[model samples]
Target: MTVDAVEEPFRTQLTVRLRQGDTLLGVPLPGPCTFTSGNGIDILWMGPDEYLVLGLELSRESSDLEAELSRESSVLAVVDVSAQRNVYRLTGVHAADVLAHGCAIDLEVAPVGTCVQTLLARTGIVLMVREDGFTVLVRQSFSDYFRAWLADASLEYVS
Candidate 1:
């Protein structure tokens, strides 16, 4: 009998929030789809009233993401989402196809350089465009199940 081993990919999540201020480290924040960059982070404008700060791997011990901004005398609230999410980067030629099985939104129309928060297989998900693939963010509790589902959906391409 032959033993089969399945190799899964690696993933990580980073939750980012910013302080309400006139500027972020001398760089002014713009309206709509604008972004501000500094301190190894990219602040993305998600909506008229919402923003998402993207950064490197954050430390689990640092529960307060707004501490730095707070110290800078900016009005901001700390958002603790350490246990709320998981992030995965999906590559390969079949990346879009794998997502098609779960996501209702058309990837072709989504276009690259855009970020969308939608549902996948009835679960909430955030999709980000990349040069060669896409990044998917989902709640932590559903990560394992989502990964398994993704593997099954990708079987056609893997074979």
Candidate 2:
């Protein structure tokens, strides 16, 4: 297995809660249990009216989004909590199998471009399936445990 911690860009995560009919930071809203991207941003839908906005080097974009959201009458809340979570990426042939050891999601059959909030090593996580692997996000407090568990889960496949 090939697992590496991703050096995230200057984080500017903006959690946006919509009041109604509001798109996310000018990007189209994602469907249920879906993710949508525009420009360099990816919006992960957390609920009917909530989303998490993420991207690389998104400082300026974050500010613009925050201000834009403030002007929208339909916006419920826009809060930045960029430092609250840590992200890691695991890619390679055995990546999914390793994650499956602790992740409840069926990565073996999940389609590409899928993202779901699930548990990894009993830790809350967001798992994003890409073309060849998965991106895992864990809350700050559990990041260390998540990483350790990932290392152990990957031992069978790692050389």
Candidate 3:
């Protein structure tokens, strides 16, 4: 018997930490820019005074984006977190059901296009739900385990 391997598309994640009173890329973000990933990237408000920037593609310099922000003020600290985390997308009708198994947040009330940083099976995960699917961000060290768990949870709907 011959079996075909399932191919999953990869999504890149870039995380940048912005300090308080610092503007991103010289662009003054008055108040926490809601739903604005800053430069069309996936950004999240990690704390009252902190923001986590994510993106699918990165520039050659690595610090290109951060440098732009630094031009405005010297108070912001931008750090590249590409090597520290893994990003995944989960979609389909059963997406919510699968997430409900391990996620602590209430998906029903979270609404679409909204992002939430929460725990999944004791591990920290950032979840963003859209109309088609949900994007999940997890630590690189736990990616393998997390993927395995996600696959297992998605078994029921794959076929």
Q: Each model's TM-score?
A: 0.70, 0.87, 0.75
lDDT string, candidate 1, 1-159, tens digits: 111222223222233345566555454554553455566555555665456655545431343444554454553444545456677778777778778898987887765655777888888977776566776777888888887887677777775
Candidate 2: clashing residue pairs, number: 0
Question: Between prediction 1 and prediction 3, which has the larger lDDT?
Answer: 3
lDDT of 2 at 153: 86
lDDT of 3 by residue, 61-128 (tens): 44665565445444456666666667777766677778888887778887665776788877898777
Deviating ranges (above 4 Å) for candidate 2: 1-7, 58-61
Best by lDDT: 2
Model 2, span 17-128: residue lDDT tens: 8888746557787777667777667788888888888865644666776686678777888898778888777888788788878877887788877778888878988777
RMSD of each: 5.5, 2.1, 4.9
Clashing pairs in 3: 25-69
- Comparison by TM-score, 1 against 3, better one: 3
* CA lDDT, candidate 1, residue 135: 67
Q: Between 2 and 3, whose lDDT is larger?
A: 2
Reference-based lDDT, residue 60, model 2: 62
Give all candidates' CA lDDT scores: 0.60, 0.76, 0.61
